[model samples]
Target: MKILELIRPAYLEVRRIGNNIRRSIEYSLSAKKKDIKIAISTVLGYSEQTIPKLINDLKKYGFSGNSIYVFEGGHNKIEHSFAGYHYYKIDHNSFDLNGLITINELNLNADYWLLLHDTVTIGKKFKKMVYTCQFKNFLGLKLLKKDVSMNIGFYSMPLIRQNSEYLHSFKNTDYTEKGLLNAKERGAIEEDYIFKNSQNIGYVHYDLQYRVKCENDVMYKGRLRRMEYYPQLDMTKYKANFVTDKEWIIKL
Candidate 1:
């Protein structure tokens, strides 16, 4: 038993290293294939620093030459010159859900429309895996689902366009009960209604590493956490969504 225990750590370490190498090779091969055309849209408030980092991160994951539509809603504006990737900026005073609605209004063109939060980073494995799923007939993959909210911040296009009417209804409201119930009434399936049923969605994958970070603190789970100092804008127009118990460090 003592000898077996002594060899266990090294064996596990070797396995971990081998797994890492395999994942690396898979990521590289996926990047090389690069057949999907994804248009990324995100609401940017004061987190201008995150935009460039996000674009760079996506490039590393093989999302090259894609269009990035940034809806700027804060006092500061974000401008980028990343080649091979098309970037557009829409100046707006909206906040939260409204900003996302503004992005939808643009009607950008792409095979898939990816909605993302400024603070959350897309994982390489998650991107590659979702890329293989069938997104044409069904709704896009749900990146983060919590409680009754589907957290539209990390979803895709035809899904966004197909459900525009219902999504636009939440422009001035929060993504809480009313928005969800409305979605269900409009023909959204149980899997589409909440984040808890993500596994039932088939094409969706939950990536814990796609996290929200504030300062040095990070919440490896849950939807992206908004910064405290960032203005809530029109979030008060609707009922507040439930806050999770996940730990987040706010830089004040």
Candidate 2:
């Protein structure tokens, strides 16, 4: 199996990015891939001093294989957030995920792509989750599906060789300003709305422990721990749809 992960570090704090990269290295080591590619994307606005170090650290942190490719861009750059942290922004109009698919000519071949934030960590339990999911799917779970569904959380996901085809099909579709505006008006956050509601995008909720350092210490100020699974909600009501402790299903 071939694996690849996309890392966007510009929106994350330097210290947080460092730790995230460290954890990514540890997670990569635990993966069972015949070939792996770490596709890292950084912004153009980051201090020239910091981006290179971060890239070097990525290379040092166990992603030195020839398959690794670093792609840099500033298109999604956001100068501020609603909370007031001046991190990169996510402009609904300017953000382009197609670039991620195109950067390494990812559209040319089908590979299991794991999209990730630069400030998240993947530990043993998380690694085990991916392995188990792949095992089950390899045994038949995903093969039965005909349409493309997306799994949420950038932590881990399974994309068949045809995922590349799905990406291109999505790219050719039109993006209406009215639709974008309506999406922004909705309760959905920019990234979530785009990834979930978009055409041909199948999503899954990953039940894995992920650690995040919020843009503000205040967001996590009183929390005993800053780690939790994606969707971060009570699951008892939907027990039939989830394992309660897992993160790979895209919510029922």
Candidate 3:
């Protein structure tokens, strides 16, 4: 190996150390001390049944998700209690894009915003991988999905700064595309746009591209169609005819 290539790893380590120290000094010297470094935001639908379990897991790491501001899109109120967790009733389903917009209006005071998918299950590696990133415009569990063709695609959470360009990007379909698609596709397209124009992007130092995947008891796992595999879930929500992005079959 060339001498430059051999020294690159050492160079990166030095940079990381420098950045961490600079970050610490900046936080310490700031006039308004931010008690919370990360503000957690999420959208809830049927995810109500799963989030508390994830919250419990987060506690094991000694990382409290201070003041979880959730946008509730379901008819029912959240029934679990965790400190610093609150939900606001909204007029839509548990869609991430709208939830993000709603969260934006609140103007949370934190060094970073951590957006989370309710069904996503993260491991202990999550804390270290995420906390180290303080200077990026975007940080997610992974990069946008790419194929062998080197195509960048949709991505999701963990956060954006309070004054990011992304917070201003989601107005309507007219904001990007000329015409409108479904809400899901519109959000995906918006995310891809953000990825393409990424000012500064970072990823969690994960072994796999995605260290965590959506997981709940019989979680809905599909890009298109869905199946309600959990027998314990209320099937009454499906009895009436519905037009949805997913065609869910009551397999249970």
Per lDDT, the best of the predicted structures is 1
Per-residue error at 53 for model 3, in Å?
0.8
Clashes of each: 1, 20, 1
Model 1 C-alpha lDDT per residue in residues 160-235, reported as the tens digit of each score? 5655775565443323445434433342233234223323232333322132222322232333333321111101
Pitting candidate 1 against candidate 3, the one with the higher TM-score is 3
lDDT minimum window of 10 residues, candidate 2: 232-241
Q: Distance from true position, residue 238, model 1, in Å?
A: 23
TM-scores, one per candidate:
0.48, 0.37, 0.50
Tens digit per residue, CA lDDT, model 2, 32-124: 552333333333333243334434444444444343333333344323322211123322221224334443233322234443323233333
Against the hidden true structure, what lDDT does model 2 obtain? 0.32
Q: Give the lowest summed-lDDT range of ten residues in model 1.
A: 230-239
Whichever of 1 and 2 has more TM-score, that candidate is: 1
Task: After superposing candidate 2 on the true structure, give the runs of residues whose Cα lies further than 4 Å from its correct spot.
Answer: 1-30, 47-50, 74-99, 103-110, 117-207, 210-252
lDDT of 3: 0.41
Q: Which regions of candidate 3 are displaced past 4 Å?
A: 1-44, 65-67, 74-84, 91-94, 134-181, 206-252
